[model samples]
Target chain A: MNTMNNKKFMMIDGLPVAIEGEKNILDVIRKAGIDLPTLCYYSALSTYGACRMCVVEGKHGEIMASCSTPPRSGMEIKTNTPRLQKYRKMVLELMLADHCRDCTTCDKNFDCKLQELAQRFGLKKVRFEPYSIWDKTDNSSLAIFRDPNKCIICGDCVRMCSEIQNVGAIDFAHRGSKMEVTTAFNMPIAETNCVNCGQCAAICPTGAITVKNDLGPLWEDLHDPNVRVVAQIAPAVRVALGDEFDIPRGTNVMGKMVTALRRMGFDEVYDTATGADLTVIEEAREFIDRLENGGKLPLFTSCCPAWFRYAEINHPELYDNISSCKSPIEMLGSVIKERAKQQETGKKPKKTKVVAIAPCTAKKFEIKRDEMQYEGEPTVAHTITTIELANMIREAGLRFEDILPEAVDMPYGIASGAGIIFGVTGGVTEAVIRYVLGSSARDHIADISFTGVRGFDGLKEVKIPYKEQELSIAIVSGLKNAENLIQAIQSGEAHYDFVEVMACEGGCIAGAGQPFVLGRAKPERADGMYEADRLSNVKLSAENPVADALYTGLLAGDKAHHLLHYK
Target chain B: MDNKELYQQIDEIINAQSSEKPIVAILQDIQEVYRYLPREAFDYLSEKLGVSLAKIYSIATFYENFSLSPKGKYVIKICDGTACHVRKSIPILDALRKELGLSGEKNTTDDLMYTVETVSCLGACGLAPVLTVNDKVYPAMTPEKAIELLGELK
Candidate 1:
């Protein structure tokens, strides 16, 4: 061991562990493979010592929060002492006393961290008297649900919204026992400027915040014979759907997912990536036109529903700068409805139900927006999260791992590698670049891969040379970074020809509706998406034969102009 | 105050500070003008300060001094600290609440004449069982005395 820089060592449970300037004792202990229980401790967010679950005894028998306490040299720490265990048990007991212990009915029943910790610590009973203080459940938002009773006042949601997304739609209100995470004047989340990102729901330790369930209507539509329920699965969902099963994180279950959806009574299972391919074609054309002629420079990609809503509410002046293109799922819905109805009635579709399975809760709200509809009927009728889809699969008694993988339905199912990468940040820009360069001056570009735009960075800036002119592109994931970029653009400090923004940190793969992993699963999931792209036969959107056929045949002239583009 | 005048006052308060204080200061000033923090004021501050509505609202609600709803003309606060609790302050609080017709969670009356609230401590421990009506203290208050004071205010 190279103990180069005055590295201190600490004894944790009588084992000497070398600590190299770690922030806290808890982190050091965690590094040593001893996973101390934490309720209010999120690695990304600020260390909130509100919950005393991570309390450990020091050398002098002083109880301190390990998360907030710094590791000192020659310090003796006792993490799992009987006294500390008793203290932690009492804390959990008190937390449970006032909590709504309806575990069977809770949305986060199996996955809730609080419940898992309690079970792990062998808490058989809570001696404290049961009491209920809060009765209000704010289901005001289209996506998020807030039950104040289940809240442990962890402040994770508050911090995540404020710090990570820069949209503090909910925060700690009042003080002490009366304190709660609520909107202004206890206003419903819908009334406030909540973008329906559902990050709060994703970070919630309990069922205090959860994505609104739309499984009932979906199930009804699935069972209905009159309704031709067509399912469109987003690229991100495939990379994350395996987490719901015992499958490891970042496992691509695309074929199995399609087969599972088909078995769950979906009339047709289509890929949202096909829609993404169409998006690339349309957006690239728009970008090229804007570059050649005079239009909004640095056109922002209008895909991530959460980012779209944030821009609309927070920065309406820049709305014109956003590309007037519907998201991949929305485009797929339009295609399915138009084509399905045309095939059925020899005219425009009247009643083809398009359901999208996505790794996003914001898609639920996006589908309900007025802009998302055509002729007063919503293009996407229903949006279900990946977790809900997994539940449906489990409910249907389908063995996801045991079942053989199947191909997706044709026409709307064929997609290129460019489309699959749309699940991660900078994918839309890269795909558009590939399409634009591949279509025009193909021989000039030697390497088709645009490695500049790919990564898990909050903000990425890249300049690519196309023929004579250089295209300046910025890829931003997370709304906070987007906010900064917007400010920079406004101040004339930065300029770009195109910008790709995704509200979630790692784009759709790490969406709030995806399976909740404690640590970030963005890098792994992004790798999985990249692997899918690598295996894809068609690397460019312009080269997709299905898209070419669609453009030349069904989506010819005014049909593509209407169905593919949105204002 | 008129919207223009209120906004002007808010602007002056914001400009008066050398460095920006926490949002509580702005909220407190707005509350001072309208007797409570108004939605319009909150929205204006949010726009001017470039702070999210949720952040401002959180700060407004966290403090006991700032009220989101319209408060009564005369606010009454009864001390319920350890000293006053031992000195039988519960009877005084009950008397005031009954007289004001404010029970349960209803701290403010329908007429908006009086609002009764309990404080952990008014920092008047020597004068135990103390109550204040719009900054005017009434120490060593009996139930009858508290009722008489409220009746006189009415």
Candidate 2:
């Protein structure tokens, strides 16, 4: 990952850099320092090119969206030309006439990109009259709010939901002026396995999506000194927390991260990796038990809360096939409380508070589930996102060196390269092979890398032979992939012995609830995972000390199987 | 409203507008006449010769316009699009309980106003908010619209 080769990057107008194969011209322009105005363009998602604001004058003398247009050699691109400006103005004027321009009371008032662009283009007088008007908001879900009047019909939310989240729960229902993005039949997002990652909101050019921020509650809790608060940081957060502090991406400041958390008023700083270690022990045993006995063959991983919710809503038939394992973040909280009782940190077990600092927005919703909520315990107290954590870090000035890299408590910090890879797509499946199949049989599998399951595609599948057994596996990254996969499974077309489904593209590293990167900077920051995985000393889940310790302690072998395997 | 009066209002609106832009506008009015746009409008448009009837007809077909056949009096158009689907629009539709005993554009009860047609998106997404009674875009349209609009026809 450290090795950089001299690669040819496509030029838009005239910018050059190392490029991936067949990249769009807009990406090339942005990669180079040229900023082009666009209403529908978003990084971390496929471009729709619906809004013509990003129009660039081509060599052919026609204006086109730089986002969707592919770049070629020696092509002349003109951005913000007089002709382009006139065209953008015309489109803006038309949009403004019908748009509800009461920005003061608008939910997205300060954050609306379309409103800012309108002002920039000086679109005060609209040429057209209002066609039809509908000003209303659907506040059905706890996490999502749908303000149709705010939507510019750019299709970013639709595409993000379909392509990135892989949840086709929402789509462009009608065509033309009547086009609206909605869930199947306008149902509340909560009913579906939306996971509420807020990635849709992240990609939205406008404020159509928002996280149901529980900070208000956390603030109230933090003031209560009687409440002993302990916060756990997820593995992926260490890699991206620096981005929140205006630090560059791929900077692994693990030591400074702990210090930052401590300064942020977290009485105790914990690691979600420890919980991830616990997941390995439970999962490995479950795999062995399932293989030996005729339980559910090739059980799917349920680490992703979004994927789990999707299964519960759309693919209820496969619910039994899914491992009922709580996400590593949740598992860590559960384990922390159980262990804290032994340590007796001056508080009763009832009053102990736990918070998870995660890169996923879905973790917010996952913590609220009935299963995650124990009868008496306050379900993981609070979930502060990586973005929020970084903000807290900056709020308190602490050097990265000031905070030494402390081991993630006991029995949980021990994760292998395989466990660390869980932050990426298909990492769970590959990790399972390391423990379940072992290294000797791993060579026979001609394709060690499942290209179909790898990369940023919506859905992928592969068949691998381990010893005499031929295992079929499916890896679904987003909700739309889940929809298509479920439909195929119901139709009896797509068959899989085991499946790994992540709610967001690129897994937890690109989780819906992670830190926000604006403009075209998202894709450029996508390579953070490979670097993190590469730097880890232990690369497999089986090798994690936390997993070994959990097996040796607390879980007396037989009880571990009963508690985790569900046999 | 009597059929003669309805036709008279249609004529008045048509005659009042300039002959230039009203070509498409007049056809739109005829569409409101028999629950669906009529074939006579297409023929008249062809004779108008300014714009081809085929082009006008193509526009009509492209949109959620009515068919050549007669329709019920209370034309009930349901939006079966995606947003409404997630909202469980089907069961709300099922609450229609019994079909209006209608076929094509017309129904058996002769209330002809109650013809059921499924539409795409009607803009009012926040309202999700489906539309009924042709262009009367209802915001936050519930199954209650089915009962309310149907009662108006009766």
Among the numbered candidates, top lDDT falls to 1
Q: Report the lDDT of model 1 for residue A22.
A: 86
Tens-digit lDDT track for model 2 on A1-567?
Answer: 112354454435554444555467777666667777787776656767788777888767887787887776546677767898889899888777767677886545655788888888887788787776584666766555677766777888766665655555566654577666665435566654465757777676676665555566666666677777787877677666766555677566666777666665667776676666667656766766776687785477888877776677556778778886767776777666656666675434436688888877777777776677644654587886766565455445565444666555334545555555566677676666656655552452225544354565656676766558877878877666666776787688877777788877666767655665533233434355555555667655666666667667755656454333322
Off by over 4 Å in 2: A1-34, A42-47, A57-77, A89-139, A147-149, A163-166, A172-180, A183-187, A192-195, A341-350, A394-415, A437-474, A482-496, A516-543, A557-567, B1-154
Weakest lDDT window of 10 consecutive positions for candidate 2 chain A: A517-526
Per-candidate fnat, comma-separated: 0.76, 0.00
Q: Per-residue lDDT for A300-377 in model 1, tens only?
A: 999899999999899999888899888999887888877776688644443579999999999999999888886688
lDDT of 2 at A253: 60
Q: What TM-score does chain B get in every candidate?
A: 0.91, 0.64
Q: After TM-score superposition, what is the CA distance of residue B144 in candidate 2 from its true location, in Å?
A: 33
* lDDT by residue (tens digit), candidate 1, B1-154: 4788878878887887657655777677667767788777878888889887777877887788888778898898999999999999999888888877888589998988888899999999999989998889989999999888876887
Highest TM-score scorer? 1
Question: What would the TM-scores of all predictions be?
Answer: 0.94, 0.67
